[model samples]
Target: MEFGLVLQTDPPAAGVVALMRRAERLGFSHGWTFDSVVLWQEPFVIHSQILAATERLVVGPMVTNPGTRAWEVTASTFATLNEMFGNRTICGIGRGDSAQRVAGRRPHGLASLGRAIDAIRDLAEGREAVVDGTPLRLGWVRDGRLPVWMAAYGPKALALAGRSADGFILQLADVDVTEWMVRAVRKAAADAGRDPARITVCVAAPGYVTADDSPAALAHAREQCRWFGGMVGNHVADLVARYGTDPALVPPELTAYVEGRRGYDYTHHGRADNPEVAFVPDGIVDRFCLIGPPAAHVAKLRRLRAAGVDQFALYAMHDARESVVEEYGAHVIPAFARP
Candidate 1:
């Protein structure tokens, strides 16, 4: 399976660029960043630097929402990057989250997200597409290619991804959830008369490599990655509101932990010490994140790959940013290298 590195465009844009460059040297094929402009820096602006610095690392938002910018503008930015940097960019988009909510708006519905995907892909690929009843095309784009990947957690979003998106991005790494979502997307693709094998499956989660599997070390690793479960709970809460916690519709493994979730504080959205995520239990952290030694990570990755995961995007959001990347580059990545 291919490997990718996920980061938040935190600051000193150069730091983000350096990490991407380092990841590229270490064999990460893709570099991703959080795109909540209000919470963090603009990812597209930083993506340019990342693309320019790295030789072969593809860069894009771990997710940008359709509501934040005009569809044409988003397509134009991507087209410009691809024009300068070879078609080495992929768009991983989803319904609004911190990007929108922090700006005082609700997440856009799946319908809007679905349309944005088509319009952005078509325009960036040098094709004409109707956006808001107007025919729009990036006239400067020549042989430009942008694979639009949709991040989804609900059934409707999943169905839309299967029927339309070039890839599916699942933000967590639970094997059962990965298996279920992959089957859902692929089945939807088949039912929609599309080739299921053509869609790329990317599983992204916080991966913290510990020194050993000792309980104390494991506990520290879990605390650092606990923020992820809360980040994911923001989406799960939405699912529960719509799907009503049905095990048949939404897996209990996903919904059960969020029962104690009172609410979230965007100020601490993806931070390691987010007090708001204290309600996130250790069990949820263990299942949602890759927290163990390299061998343990390889074992879970093997299961994920066997479950049809084509790529695993490691979220280096904790304190051991460089160390985890180095470990994955040295131990985890080589374990799956093709001869």
Candidate 2:
């Protein structure tokens, strides 16, 4: 399976670029950044620097929302990057989250997300599409190649990812959940008359390599990554609201953990010390993150790959960023590379 790193685009843009460069040298194929403009640095502008500096590191937002910018602008920015950087760009999108909520608006519905995906993918790929009721196409894009991946948690969003997106991005790394969701997407693809094998399955989560699964060490690892469960809770809460508490509507696995989740604080979103994430239990953190040694990680990743995962992206959102990347490069990544 391919490996990628998800960064938050924090502080010095150069630091972010350096991390991406390091990741590429260490064998990561993709570099993704959070696109919450208000909370972090803009990712597209940074994507240019990342693509320019690296030989083969594909870069894009881990997710940018359709509500934040005009569809044409998003498509054009991607097309421009691909034009300058040898078609090494991918667009991972979703219904708005921190990017929209922090700006005092609700996230856009799935319908808008579908339209934006269609327009952006078509325009970037040198095809005609309609955006905002006007027929449009990127006149300058001759051979732009951009793949649109959709991030989803709920069934409907998963269905949309299967039916429309070039790939599916699942932000958690639990093997059981990954298996179930991958089946859901592939089944939806088959039902829609699309090639199920053509869709890529990318499982992204925080990964911390430990020497052993000792309770103390494991406890520390969980603390460093518990923020992820809370970050995901933002989406799970929405699912509960829309689909209700019925397991038939939403999987019990996704909604059960969020019972104690009173609310989330965007100020601490995706950070290591998100105090507000106390509602998230240790079980969820351990289950959601890859928190053991290299061998353990390899085992879990193998299971996910067997379950049809094409790529596994690590969210370097913790204290052990360099160590995790280095260890994976040295141990975990090589295990899966072609013989």
TM-score to true structure, per model:
0.99, 0.98
Positional deviation of residue 329's Cα in model 1 after best superposition, in angstroms: 0.7
Q: Write the per-residue lDDT of candidate 1 for residues 122-232, one digit (tens) a residue.
A: 999999999999999788999999999999988888999999999999999999998999999999999999999999999999999999999999999999999999999
Over 4 Å off, model 2: none
Number of backbone collisions per candidate: 0, 0
Give the lDDT of residue 5 in candidate 1: 97
Candidate 1, overall lDDT? 0.94
Give the candidate number with the greatest lDDT: 1
- Show pairs that collide, candidate 1: none
Model 1 regions more than 4 Å off: none
Candidate 2 lDDT, tens digit per residue, 143-216?
88999999998989999999999999999988878888898999899999999999999999999999898999
